[model samples]
Target: MTTKKIIQDFYKSEAFINVSEMEPYLHPEFILEWQSSKGFSKLDKQGVLDLTKELSASYVRSKIRILSLVQEKNQVAVRYSHFVKTVENPREEMLLAHFFVIWEVKDDKLYRGYQMSQIS
Candidate 1:
């Protein structure tokens, strides 16, 4: 899948809270990061999916703004802002963060994505 398609599917799933379709775009080792109420935190591949799946349970919306995306061969880097809110906390929080994600694809499926993120 192309980078644009990744963004597209993510947004599309945003509507239905169905991220399974996006699993293909993500590298198996994918890492998703965010700032906790205290400090920065990160999630590895399983962590990312687990978090997304859980959040989708309580959340009705998840938005991502791509600042930039550049991929050279297997590596993909993205800078973005994410807006999220959980069921317990009804207030939405917006985080402007930059991320560097390393990607490796196998069998035409995203195999791994090692990533890091921080507030911008």
Candidate 2:
């Protein structure tokens, strides 16, 4: 599958329902990044997993809707709306942003990825 397809599948995977299903899209050295109103930051893939694990307790569902897709060379930039439902709050809210992701893919392995998400 193409990178886009793989990424889309990751969104639809059971991981969104149960955090443990995240294995397919996660690599040991994985990295995930996103910006808040404060500033940009970095998270190792483990950090991403940890965040999800913690969130699983409070957030019942998570979903990403692709708004746009742009690809050049080995990079893919995707604009999306990240939707989440808080277990306690029970209200779903969305944060719209675009992510710039650069991946180092060697054969079937994804060695690393750097991602940046900005408010849109």
Candidate 3:
């Protein structure tokens, strides 16, 4: 698959809370640098997996809307909004965050990512 397609699919899987499906797309050394309201954190692939699993326990559902996407060579940049509904308040959906991320593809898998997010 194309790098762009792979990146897009990753986001889709995340929204669906399919962490296991997302793993195959990641390189062993995959890492993400995240900048957020709290501060910055560097996360390895396992860290991301753990985070997602934790989030799944609190949120009943989630959605991702990609506002912009661009791919150059093996790199992709994306801007997206994330929405989620907590298990305690399933009827009310809330904006989780807005994100801007750049991912580097290696061996047809996501090798590195850098992202910033604004919490809502």
Candidate 4:
């Protein structure tokens, strides 16, 4: 698959709230450097999985709305918003955050990412 297609699939897969589903899209040595309203964090593949696990416990499902997507070679840049249905109120979907991320795909998996986000 193309790099852009891989990234689009990853976001639309609800992998953010389904930890097990995300593993296939991540490189073994994946790393994410993130800056958010809460602050900055650096996460390795395992760290990302752990965070997704926590998200899975809190959210029943998630949706990613892609505002913009651009690809150049093995890198993709995406601007999107995340919406989630909480475990407490699965009937209601709420905006979770807005993000801009640049991802490097290696071996057809997400290798490195630089991301910025704002809580909604």
Give lDDT per model, in order.
Answer: 0.59, 0.63, 0.88, 0.95
- List candidate 3 segments past 4 Å from native: none
Query: How many clashes would you count in candidate 3?
Result: 0
Error of 4 at 44 (Å): 0.2
Q: Is candidate 2 or candidate 3 better by lDDT?
A: 3
Q: For residues 1-120, write the lDDT of model 3, one tens digit per residue.
A: 999998888887753455776678879999999999999999998887788788888998888889999999999999999999899999999999999999999998989999999998
In model 4, the worst 10-residue window by lDDT is 11-20
Instruction: Estimate, for each residue in 1-120, the C-alpha lDDT of model 2 and write its tens digit.
Output: 676666666656657446577755676666655565558767776676677787688767777877776656545566566667777766756553555555544333344666666666
Candidate achieving the largest TM-score:
4
- Which regions of candidate 2 are displaced past 4 Å? 14-17, 89-111, 118-120
> What is model 3's C-alpha RMSD?
1.4
Per-prediction count of colliding residue pairs?
3, 1, 0, 0
3 or 4: which has the higher lDDT? 4
Model 4, residue 58: what's the lDDT? 96
Best by lDDT: 4
TM-score of 2: 0.71
What does candidate 1's lDDT look like per residue over 1-120, in tens digits? 775455445444563244675565566665555554446666666666666677689765667776777677754666666666666675865553555555555555556555566655
Instruction: Order the candidates by lDDT, highest first.
Output: 4, 3, 2, 1
- Residue pairs in clash, model 2: 30-45
TM-score of 1: 0.58
